[model samples]
Target: MRIVLDGISRQMVDRKVKAGQVLAVPGPSGRRIYPTFQFAADGSLLPGLPAVLAALPTRDPWAVLNFLVNPDARLGGRTAVDLLRDGRVDEVVRAARHLDDQGA
Candidate 1:
């Protein structure tokens, strides 16, 4: 992941995760594993990802991943990540904001 980030320091990555500016899921070995999907090919975060992350109902990384990958009715049966990849960030964020109301 560091290589993908172009050699960004661990501390910097940690800070980003802590700030809710990046997503890092826990691996089997208890290491935080950063998902590549959240980043563009150039290694920057997908646009508006930070806002979506912030709007998520849960801070749990696993829940966050599930929310992003699962199809949501609010998003017209598309996954949040899919909408994000398509640059429909406002729609994703809107869904995320209402996730808790739907008992997600």
Candidate 2:
């Protein structure tokens, strides 16, 4: 499956996305194609990326940060997807934001 993200969602991705612009997927098998460069690629959508943050449990601006960086600190390729599926994304973001706010 493929998705196109835009608007505030686009900003969210831009803030945390890598140069490759890899969208967080459901599993490791989900291919991460660069939508900005290739519009019609297998496992990718058209125009732009999908609004993943919009689908989150809350509208916290920090959630996108947590999602993108959370996987950076983990070895498991599917860690980010797991966080989303389990509904712990918001909690993780909140905790991360709190830590950041406290300078910890």
Candidate 3:
């Protein structure tokens, strides 16, 4: 799921995106599409999410999104986002580094 930044608190979204704590992707129509995964049901950022984002292979939004949702062998066939929510930050970081090692 995705949300237009304006759908939420614009100021907070802008600040988070600027701080590299949130990912704002360019949508087909040239609007910013914020990934819904970045926010909890309560509209708060998931704990330790920014660190996971920082450890990702690339800053390209699509790449980041793919990484977050794709299942990984190292994660026992679970998506990185699942592991992150399960508090498996170190494992996620290692998996992310694996992507870098393969030059993804």
Candidate 4:
């Protein structure tokens, strides 16, 4: 992640994670591992990711990650991350708001 972020300080990365601007899942050794899919090629957070994160019903990192990557019928069978990548932020946010409505 440091390499991908162009060597930004670890503190900065941690701050981003703490601020809910980035996604970091737990690694096997209990270290935070940032998922590359959450970042654009330029190492910035994917557009509208922060808003989607805020809209998600849960704050658990694993559940949030699963919601982002897993297929959802609410999204017409497309993953939230894919829709976000395609600039369909509103649709994803709407789906997220109703994640539990249909037991997603």
Query: How do all models score by TM-score?
Result: 0.89, 0.26, 0.80, 0.88
User: What RMSD, rounded to one decimal, does every model reach?
Assistant: 1.8, 11.3, 3.2, 1.8
Between candidates 1 and 2, which one is better according to lDDT?
1
Instruction: Give a tens-digit lDDT track for model 2, residues 43-73.
Output: 2432222334333343333454354345534
Q: Judged by lDDT against the true structure, how good is candidate 4?
A: 0.85
Clashing pairs in 4: none
Q: How close is candidate 3 to the true structure, as a TM-score?
A: 0.80
Q: Which 10 successive residues of model 4 have the least lDDT summed?
A: 1-10
For TM-score, the strongest prediction is: 1
Report lDDT (CA) for all predictions: 0.87, 0.40, 0.77, 0.85
Off by over 4 Å in 3: 1-8
Looking at candidate 1, what is the lDDT of residue 93?
A: 93
Write candidate 4's Cα lDDT for 20-96 as tens digits.
87889999888888888887777777889989888888889999999999998889999999999999999999988
Over the stretch 1-104, how does candidate 1's per-residue lDDT look in tens digits? 35365457779888999999899998887988998888877777888889999998799998899889899989988899999989899999999888889454
Question: Residue-wise lDDT of candidate 3 within 17-53, one digit each (tens)?
Answer: 7777898888888888877876777677766778877
At residue 67, give the lDDT of candidate 4.
90
Residue 36 Cα positional deviation in candidate 3, in Å, after optimal superposition: 1.2
- Looking at model 1, residue 41 earns an lDDT score of 79
- Which prediction has more favorable lDDT, 1 or 4? 1
